[model samples]
Target: MQNKYVNKVLKFLKWGAFILIILIAYTIISARITGADPSFMGYQFKNVLSGSMEPTFRTGSVIQIKLTEKEGTEYEPGDIITFQRDGILITHRIIEKIIHGDAVTYRTKGDNNDGPDIDAIPAGAVLGQYTGITIPWIGYPLGFASSKLGALILFLIPGVIFLVFGVHYLRGWRLSRG
Candidate 1:
C-alpha cells in the first residue's frame, strides 16, 4: 500500500512539473515572437522590475494584471494600475484624477516613492489593473529562463531526461517480449 501511494505521488509530481514546463516554454516562445507578454483568461503576467511597490509587492515578484478594455473601464483613486509612459511600462497607484472637457488623466505615485510621478498620464495610456496575485521571487528564475542561454538549459535538461527514460522503457519492452 505504501509503495502504491509513493508511486501515485511521484506521478502527480511529474505531471505538475510537465505542466509548469509547458507554460514557461509557451511564455518564452510567445514573447520572442510577438514582443509582448502572453495572456491567459484576460490576465497577463509581468515581473516587478523595481521596488516601487514594496510592502504591497516587492521587487523580484511576479504579478498578474487583469486586462480590460480601455473605453469601458473607469479608474479611480486608490486603485493600482499598470500604464505606459514614454514607451516604458509602470505600475503605480492612482492618487488623483484630472478631467478636462472629455479628456481624463491620472496622477500616479509609487508606494515606495516620496512624491507623485512627474506627469499625469492620459486615460488612453492605461494598460491594465493589478490583480493582487503575486508569486514571490519567481521573477528571477522566469527572467533567466527567458534568455537564450537559460532557455537552452531549461529545455535541454528535460530533453535528456526524457530521452533516457525512453531508452529504458524500450529496453524493458524488448526484454519482456523476448
Candidate 2:
C-alpha cells in the first residue's frame, strides 16, 4: 500500500511537470513567432535589456505590463510605456504629450537617462503601459531562451532526460518479462 501510494504521487508529479513544461514551451515558441511581446490575458511579458529605467526597473528584470483602460484612454503623461523605435522596443516614462491638429505625440525619457529622447514618439508607436509588476533576474533566463543555442539547451535537457528514463524503464520491463 505504501509503495502504491508512492507510485501514485510520483505519477502525479511527473504529469504535472510535463504539463508545465509544455505550457512554457508553447509560450516561448509563441513569443518567438508573434514578434510582439509575450502576452496572455492582457498582460505582456517584457525583459528589460538596459538600465535606462533603472531605479524603477533594473536591467535583466522581467516586467509584466497589464493593459489598463480602453485603447484611447490608457495613455497619459507620467505613464511608463513601451514603444517601437527603429525596429527595437524601448520602454520609458512619458514626460510630455503634444497634440498637433489630429495627432498625439509623446516626449519620453528614461529615469536614468541624461535627457528626454530627441524625437517625439507618435501615439501609434506605443505598445502598452507598464503595470508596475516586476520579477527580478527572470530576464536573464528569458533572454538566454531567445537565442537558438539557449533554446536548444532548454528543450533538449528535458527531452534527453525523458528519453533516458523511458529506455531504462523499457529495459527493465523486458528483463522482467524474460
Candidate 3:
C-alpha cells in the first residue's frame, strides 16, 4: 500500500513538472516572437494600472488590443481604445470624433471619470482598439514576467527544481546498481 501511494505521487509530480516546463517555454517563445511591439501582428496585451475604466475592467486586469490602422478605420463613439500620451499609454472610450480636412481626432473619457479628456487625440497617436477580452487579476503576474525578478521566477526557479529532481533520480539509480 505504501509503495503504491509513493508511485502515484511520483507520477503526478512528473506530469506536473512537464506541464510547467512547457508553459514556461511557450510564454518565453511567444513574447520573443512578438518582439514587445504593440503594433506587431496588430495585437498587444496591456495591464490595467488604474481604476479609470472601473466597472468595465478593474485595476490589475489584462486586456488584449487589436491595432487600428489610420486608413479604412472609422472611429466611432463609445469605442474603447489605447493611445499614447506623453509616453504613457491611456485606455479610454471615444465620446466623439472630429475631422479636419484629411486628419481625424478623438475625444475620449474614462468610464469612471466625470468629464471628457482635456485634449483630443490625433489619429496618428492611436495604438489599438480593445477587443473586449479582459482577464481579471492576471496582469499582476504578467507584469512580473517583464522584470528582472520575473526572469528569476520564470526561469531560475523552474531550472532549479528540475535540477534537484534530476539529481535525486540519479542518486536513486546509483543506489539500485550497488
Best by lDDT: 1
lDDT of 1 by residue, 49-139 (tens): 9999888999999999988576413889998999999999999999998988888899999999999999998888888999889999999
lDDT for model 2, please. Answer: 0.86
**What overall lDDT, based on C-alpha atoms, would model 3 receive against the true structure?**
0.86
For 128-166, candidate 3 gives per-residue lDDT tens digits of: 899999999998998888788896787888788888988
Candidate 2 least-lDDT 10 residues:
65-74
User: Which run of 10 residues does model 1 get worst, by summed lDDT?
Assistant: 66-75
- Clash counts per candidate, in order, are 0, 0, 0
**lDDT per prediction?**
0.88, 0.86, 0.86
TM-score of each: 0.85, 0.82, 0.72
What TM-score, to 2 decimals, does candidate 3 have? Answer: 0.72
Candidate 2 stretches with Cα past 4 Å from truth are: 1-7, 67-73, 168-178
Best by TM-score: 1
Q: What is the lDDT of residue 97 in candidate 2?
A: 88
Candidate 3 residue pairs in clash (backbone atoms < 3 Å): none
